[model samples]
Target chain A: MLDVKAEAAEHSGAGAPGEEAPPLVVEGLGHAFGERQALRNVSFRLNRGDRTMLLGLNGAGKTTLFSLITRLYNHRSGSIRIFGFEIKDKPSEALARLGVVFQLATLDLELSVAQNLLYHAALHGLPRREAAVRLKREIERVGLTDRLREHARTLSGGQRRRVEIARALVHQPKLLLLDEPTVGLDVASRQFLLDHVRMLCNEGGIAALWATHLIDEVDSGARVIVLHHGQILAEGPVPEVIRRANASSMREAFDKLTGERSE
Target chain B: MRPIHYARCLRGIIWREALRFINQRGRFLAALVRPLVWLLIFATGFRFVLGVSIIPPYQTYIPYQVYIAPGLIGMILMFQGMQSSLSMVWDRETGSMRTLLVSPLPRWYLLTSKLIAAVIVSVLQAYVFLFIAYFWGVHPPRLGYLTVLPALILAGMMLSGLGLFLSSVIRQLENFAGVMNFVIFPMFFASSALYPLWTVKQANLKLYYICMANPFTHAVELIRFALYEKFNLEAFAVVGGSLVIFMTLAILGYDPGRGLIARRAGTE
Candidate 1:
């Protein structure tokens, strides 16, 4: 059982109808390597109708947590339930419900857009017609309809990121896990990606766990899971956590929570 | 799950790897060239001095080229396994491995899909080598040709498993060349590829047992036995036994916490 009392207080004001099953959930999760305690009894939840951005410093176990949730690597102790299924015992079924855009460019550079989509679709076991229909929508949504014939490697950084997002949605997964999706994008592209994510949560009710370290990317209203030393230092709406830390902004809250200001 | 989907996934993985190789035309040529040299040049030169024997599957005495067809096929599986696996290591270094590792599919299935694809491509390439041998006057099994399917699959599984194991542990392609030299060549030479195991006893008995210990020898033996339209029980055991060990290590090598993926070790 996770102590969500503080979290509930912060998020209780959001009138999002009911508290639907969070798209992603981590409970009492912990991990370590040799002498390094990577994650310590971490626990949190994110709803599908809500946008939750994971905030953490470098080596604060941000990627490690994402790796565990995406089932990229193993967690030492704890349970990670995505859409109500544990990753360890029911990986295939549970994982099938997940769409992930890793921090690195996972696209095969030489493959054409259509070819890449088909490959991913087949791999995810999506029906041909349904995959095609969704593929069209996703491509146009990302404004990449014209570049569908181009190779992934030839596209600009922003275009490649867009393609990665489109590729992740080809299966219409209930949960989307993005690891710092807009890291290197220019101003326009970053805004474009953020806007697309907002649409995903608002229109499709698709839950997303958007991992990032930037405060600007964390919208004023979205839930924030602040990670410090591989542990959850704070959670819930961005504004409340800032108020709790008695800080002026989310960055100030983060610095105080992680002991940076104390130092 | 419809079996067709699994079939489709298998095809997609296979197609990607194959197409990638096709895009790298130079690699394809080199893949073909390596075997051609072993068959036309090395085997041909040794054919006279190979000391012909009534090796089973060979109903009557035959030329060394005829005897080594299956071995040549074995070579294809082994090299292709290494080549794809080398790419896997490179993919990890370049950060693409993380992309596939995160796919919702079971890690084993994702890996099996890759191994299966590599096997198919290697099998097709093996057939091309077989056709060339046929034209070169090398006598191959007539009805025994059909058995090549299982033989090739078994061979592919074995080599791919080996390559997977190699990829998990070996960090860089630069270190891989040494691994190939030390592990691959000996496995190929000591096996019943160029010479029969029993014959090896006449020249060197200790060396014969070492070859017998190699799983690759069994892979070669399995293909070699199938080549003659005769079932060799020992070949079956060798191939099966190697598969067991290779798959076990392959799985362990790729294991998240203890294996290469987590440890970031070059080769396991």
Candidate 2:
């Protein structure tokens, strides 16, 4: 295999002029536990105002990569710069600038919708008055105003998932890292979430990395990174990657790249 | 995330515990029976075989029931602390604990908050046990004994710390029950809670040293001395040392990268 970690300079295309540094610049990332290697010298840079989609199969190390980015786990040999600060040297600062919604919903189902969001906002240290204003705006954006007074346990899975995403954005992070954001969502809710995420990337100028196994979630204009069996199989503009793929749908392209075939 | 914001998360965790217990009063009532059985039936029956004498803070003769109060209270704290933490394993099994752990806040603070809430419940249950002992006619100096508060707090902190450590280490909820056999009973039985170190010395010289070595014994002795309105510096030091050591272990147990909670859960 080519040395992906050593090619950082070649791949580090600075964002367009007037655009800020990439929200995340990861290079030579590697980790292992005892004898089992979890990640191997992975390198990728994600810039602000860029809407990048990450497609990977199960066991593709997507969650491990996200966990390391969040510093839920530390990297053994790598450098991760989030918002211009090394993650280890300044974890709170780096994490504060990024909003993350993991595959599992972090909403407290026992608490009222408002209570859950308020609690999370307080965790991020948003002042009460400030959080209230942001909470109102984000809740409405997710169409959860009517459900604020009810317990999250009562909301449907889609509604609960949306509320969780809104909770992550209450602090106005510069980057949004969503892991399988639409998992278990009905078709309508999935579309609703995708539309809002795209809007956030374009209108708010927020950089985002949406990790999913679903190919249809990718937007035509976005950059794409395809991971398979713990390695990056492809990375480039969506159209160009597919042009090389020579497949009709993005799924076919993903399958062709990963060498999976229909039964 | 801001570090001080952790206090709010702690309050939220305590609130969850309070809500669950209030909704299920039967659990507290049910737990009360075990200690009551030990105190009224077992202690009374064993009193005849065991000789009693004057220890410090005792004006004259003391009954076996009064002697074992501090030990029983220590037992309450340890078990309740383990009870709350063991339930965390249950929460993880059912997938609720994941919701709490994945929040932006640090994981250690979340476990600490849960421990504090468990301590409150344990201390409250202990107070109830004291009141029932009063009705059973095993009274000590009521006002002087209020020192039990600080003593209970110290013991509660230690037990909570112990429980937090276990939550991270145990592989499965069922395996945690085994922890009780190895840890809980030995610590309680070998402590000075049931008898003074002097009494243990008369019976078994080695046993006296073991009781002196048990930190729980010091917690019970601290409460015992305080009940008579006397303070033992050595006992106080032991309690303090145990709290610090246990809390340090708990902090290490919560390190996400190496924590046993995930390791045992088979999630990694």
Candidate 3:
């Protein structure tokens, strides 16, 4: 499965080979605001076709780390690389392979769904004809094919999020970074989103880093990185992390790890 | 990125701006009404009070309405520029600006595209105002209209660049009202838009110098001369120089590593 999608990505010119570097790499990433350190010594690597859950409580620097990775905020003390291209040095090459669904909904409410998606596709330099085809395919994937002409404001919250996911995929990015993508979502909507993204990673060979504070979202088969107070408390396969914390489930493991640090 | 990519991105940004402008019926009305009020009522009321000598652009004595038509056009461009700035701030607050920022293109190219989009909208608005003014007996030479296009574009670029610079520094949508009072109003009132420089010179030498120093004044002068099929070298130089300066500063202000975004990153 991985090889099939990897070959597709290579042919599509989405993945640039750089000594076969991983999809994403963060090394000694540190960021501070005046006197308050928001993120400290954050280091991780996400390989192709990997699904990693970045689990943390509120104020654990999840958003800050995402911001640096997205290049929304500059990282002064560390480095971030995408496909072996450093973010600061070769942002165009680095960001070309990245797709992001931010926590906040960024759609222009006045524009139709298709318009919003096409605008994003153009930003990624896709030709108009190709963008239109991808727009149809991606929106169909999210089950919004019938709502293409509807204004974004007319869509419900769940529908809006699905469109955002479709927009992120229109460029055929190799790595998808979703920051609390399921926040404020209903149970059904959340499950649909979680499943859709995981399926994309598994079948398309697109590396994904899903950040969330919700424990139920992390499956046992997934790798987990537990962050607490701007530091990583544990990182491994979900079951291994649970075993290391001496807890039976992810919830207990997370509580135990964060609880010990708070004391 | 290829040149084709840049061209497509520019087309997309401008198309988006045009679509937004078309959708906001109230915004279109407001842009026209503000300038029309000055032409129909304000200029009419002051027609006799503000007597005009035969200026270089004016071959003979003209009514205040005709004299101020270009000023009203300048007003449209300035207000549209400020409106673009307000929308930028709103986009930032709503997180749509992040969508643009995270694109694979260079930051400077993205910002320049945005500025060009804004200038295109402002110029369209200016032409609409000029068309209305034509029916109001504010006719310039037929060739004047064609000549004014370049001036309107240059002046629009300068004003929009100013707005773009202001948008980068203004942190919040709420703070934009302060900019209206502190920047827009002052710029409009202290320029040659409403009155001639000589009139202000007679009133106060210091005020005249202030007007001379004001970039808005030069923008108004540029538009005034272009409306008469002439060019003011000084005004052209000043407006062009201001466009370069403002555009450079606006680009720097949006730079992720060394700009205002870096300073505010911790808070976000």
Top TM-score model: 3
Off by over 4 Å in 2: A1-21, A182-189, A219-222, A261-263, B1-34, B44-51, B86-90, B93-114, B170-175, B193-210, B256-267
Interface RMSD of 1: 3.4
Flag clash pairs in model 1.
B169-B266, B169-B267, B169-B268, B170-B266, B170-B267, B171-B266
> Which candidate leads in lDDT?
3
- lDDT over C-alpha atoms for residue B189 of model 1: 90
lDDT of 1 by residue, A1-263 (tens): 12253255235432222233345678899876667788899998776567889988777788878877876567789888766677877677667778888887778886777667877887876667877888888999999999888777778889888988998888788688899888888999999999998898877777788988888888886889999888899998999999999999988898889977421
Distance from true location, Cα of A64 in model 2, Å: 1.3
- List residue ranges in candidate 1 displaced over 4 A: A1-20, A261-263, B1-8, B15-26, B47-49, B59-63, B93-105, B169-175, B252-268
A best-first ranking of the candidates according to their lDDT comes to 3, 1, 2
Docking quality (DockQ) for each candidate: 0.35, 0.23, 0.62
Candidate 3 lDDT over B1-268, as tens digits, reads 7999888888888888888888886878787998899999999999999998888788999999998888888888888887785576566434668888878999889888888888888888888888898898898999998899999999988988888888777666356577778888888889988888899999999999999999999999999999899999999999999999999998888887874876666666
For all candidates listed, what's the TM-score of chain B alone? 0.89, 0.89, 0.95
Q: What is the lDDT of residue A206 in candidate 3?
A: 81
What's the residue-level lDDT of A209 in candidate 1? 86
Residues A35-69, candidate 3: write the lDDT tens digits: 99888899887877888999988889999888888
Q: On a 0 to 100 scale, what is the lDDT of residue A241 in model 3?
A: 94
